[model samples]
Target: MSEFRITGKAKLAGVIGHPVTHSLSPVLHNYWLARKEIDGAYVPLSVAPDVFVTAVKGLQASGFRGANVTIPHKEAAFAIADEVDPMARIAGSVNTLVFREDGTIHGSSTDGFGYIANLEADGIDVTALANRGPALLLGAGGAARSIATSLLEKGFQVIFSNRTAERADGLANELDAAWRRHFPKGDAPRLSTVAWDKWEEQLSELALVVNTTSLGMQGGPAPDWTPDLSRASSHLVVSDIVYVPQETLFLKAAKERGLTTSGGLGMLLHQARPGFKAWFGADTEVDEATAAYIRAALNKR
Candidate 1:
């Protein structure tokens, strides 16, 4: 077993997920605590899907302030929360969970916030750009759903551009946005499908592109996106949520074009800030130094 290192602080906050060890939340939260000189501590707790209920209940029962959920447990976190933020309710998943003093759980998904942060960190003006052009979102999973949910409500023109037409259409319907079977040719930023063979063909006109698919993660094949995207992206903002690798091919292409590019790391850091504030207080920002180190460490890995 690894050594248990504890910083002396009475208050407890943690992140809950099956593979919680890989999370950077602890470093972010503890860094905030250290900076603020607050007498609290945060840690990571590994909890399997089947044990979610018990694990969450146990945290609430203890002095634990709250926890963040990741991956397979986001939906479970939402289902078990006593109350959920409006955005989280719409997203149908919760990544940032708060265990309140009243034994009530307040669930929220920060995936969108994180995605937005990734854009901002990479020098993209998220608020300005999202409002200006149509965003091509690439997946329909919980993470994509949350990001689309937020972007739509924010009045951004987000279109579903996934390979799987049915799921993408369903997500668009749920969000009350537009959807289609395939990317319509000849202009008009439309929400539709991208045929497996036609991704690169549409790269020239995209204003912003997002990759919600887990394709670039775990040493897998790169995303089947368009070529010269970086050059094409000179007029676009390109981002991907695959943070395991600091630079994915998707962003690499965008960077090559000198376009605005962002990685998944910023989103990880930004999304946790709101949750940490909810767990502790609004006065806290994620520890920037810690977060920077975490990013560096991840890049090195």
Candidate 2:
């Protein structure tokens, strides 16, 4: 790391969340800011839900570049954006925002991009995986939606299995409609749903399985819960989006079985690249050093 310094021409950005004291955005973004040696700052803003809009307007007025929205503010960010990318509109949330010189705000959801980018970064051939078989997503929440949309775009058959079967069905239908609307003449996306408990039985036919639920987070749904990967094919790729413990139990089981696996940390790192570029005018790459920096930060907490 180099000595941190900023001047009157420094670019400014931050993250907005209701209770954002724990966000790693500052750690991740500031690392890139310093490594690139750009006169920019990325901070964390703990704003109440009611004042999110006002705070955003204030940032814009102060010539701030942009801010990332997390948790409860993702939807609000989408609502306030002057324009949004298709991913954000389809995902129903926004995580990255850019304030243009013309005073317009643009919002985008990088979850999908990060999800696929991380897999590719791990040397998993996504296009070949899509050709192998369908992908089974364990939860149908926001992360699942974003991942599903991205997979569907890449010609993968996406299957959803959530604790609530109805929610999975609804997500499938919503995404199906959106996919068709986006590509009316293109092939309709292969989307389906399976019962939560039966997902394991069908793993043999899946090329990839992702746990988008918090089942394996350090303080999430279940401390010791992990999916049964016994029935998964030898080629099945396992992934989890919960990065706190880095190697979630879900990923552990897959690793123990000798199957390829990807953790959530890479997604977290890659997801910040787009925002970093938009805010700092630099393209950042995630390599071993970058991963180690974030891993050290997580270990500290």
Candidate 3:
């Protein structure tokens, strides 16, 4: 491996969070920068909740190109942004931020873009999934919002299931309204919620099942029950957003049943591309080499 050179003129980008030291953004983005020979640098910034606004403003004022928002800062990023892209607006959160020379910030959410990109990268035909049937999305949190919205925009009916019934219902209604407000004349994707207890019963009707919750994550509680794959559609594709352990128990169960499975790291990799383009002026590729580099870095963690 060669060293990455930087000068005072190098452009700056980074990831922001309360505890950002563990972020892999620096590794992923720097790999692209080094490979493409771009004179840019990506770092990690740990900003607390109370001073998030001040820190973001300071970054913009200090000539930093942009930063990726994480955890508690996504909502704040959306609120402070001078401009919000359609994806950010619809998802009601922003993970990527671009700083303008005039001290303004642009906000966008690439979570969904990355989610679908991950599936496509794995050779899963998203269009075919949309055509086959509705996708079952587990969780009603910020990540799920972006993913559900993205699937909806792609004309895929989404069935959202969360442990809390009200939260799931609330997200479904919010997304439906957002969809109607944004694409009034277009045929809205069917959005509905299922009780947590009932999600398994609908598996047979779903072509894709995605777990966006933290359940089964390392250190988190394991999923109480695995979906009965015997009753699921033969074309079912199971995905989980928990990537640290790489393959979550949900994915392991899916694999045992011989269903297609996708891990969350791809989303993390793919989502960085848009922000890299915004800051570095070039669209980066999420190739195998880049994936391998990140994987190696993750293992070291």
Candidate 4:
């Protein structure tokens, strides 16, 4: 890629987290800036929790386009945003922020968008998957909620499974209530909770099995916790949202079982597309070249 030239008129944006030096957003955005030949810059901002609000205000005052909120700052971003999209409100977090000319910050969560975009990029028709059967989401955290909401919106029956049964139940109930409030008499989205230990039992009836938990992540809570997919149907699609190691254990097991699988890297790339356009006013593609670039960066790490 060519070197990016930042002039006085450069568009400014970044990613914010407490310890953000490890973020690859700079690489991703900078690559796009250089590729698009735009006078823009994307940086990483390490802001402590106590000063999140002050830092965000300072960024808005300094004419920043916006920034991607990461880690512990997502909730803070949502709280401080002057306006938020419905998905951001439902997810209760904001991963992307846009600073408007009126000095107001707009926030939205792109995790779900990214997740579905990645699947589509792989030529896995999400709507078709929904039609095939329900999706079994293997977690109840923020990521799970976002993915579940997306699946539910896509006409997929969403069943959540988490280590803590209460967390799973609560998330199911919460989303169910939200759906009802939004579409009073509309067809209720199928939302249910399953025991984490017994999620494998639902394999035959599921069209997709997603691991939104940190179980199979590289340095996550349980890196070795890949599930047995011996009973998975031939048409089942296994997906995991942990990208550090690229081919996570969960995906590995699915692949070994001769089932289709989607990894987290695609989701990461797809999710950043919206924020890139919002901040730089330029459209970017998450194609093979972009994926290769990100993979090279990951290999170096």
| TM-score winner | 2
In candidate 4, where is summed lDDT lowest over 10 consecutive residues?
1-10
| Tens-digit per-residue lDDT, 1-301, candidate 3 | 3354677778999999988887889999989988888888999999999999889878877789999999879989999998998867878899999998877788999999999999999999999889999999999998899999889877799999999889999999988888788878978759998988888988888899999988877767774435566777778999998887888877888899888999999999999999999999999888889888998998887
lDDT of 1 by residue, 1-301 (tens): 1133344545788888888877877877877766666667788899989999998888888868888888679889989988877777767788877777777878888888777765666676666876667777777877888888667655567766666778887777765522221213423323455653465566666677788888776566555544445335457777788877668877776776787777777777778778777766746543457557777767665
- Measured on C-alpha atoms, candidate 3 has an lDDT of 0.88
The digit string of per-residue lDDT tens for model 4 on 74-160 reads: 889889998988767767789999999988889999999999999998889898899999999888888998888888888999999
What C-alpha lDDT values do all the predictions have?
0.72, 0.91, 0.88, 0.89
Candidate 2 collision pairs: none
Q: lDDT of model 2 at residue 101?
A: 98
RMSD of 2: 1.4
**TM-score-based ranking, best first?**
2, 4, 3, 1
Model 1 regions more than 4 Å off? 1-9, 177-192, 223-233, 282-288, 299-301
Name the better of 1 and 3 by lDDT.
Answer: 3
lDDT of 2: 0.91
For each candidate, what TM-score against the reference? 0.82, 0.96, 0.94, 0.95
- Candidate 4 accuracy as TM-score: 0.95
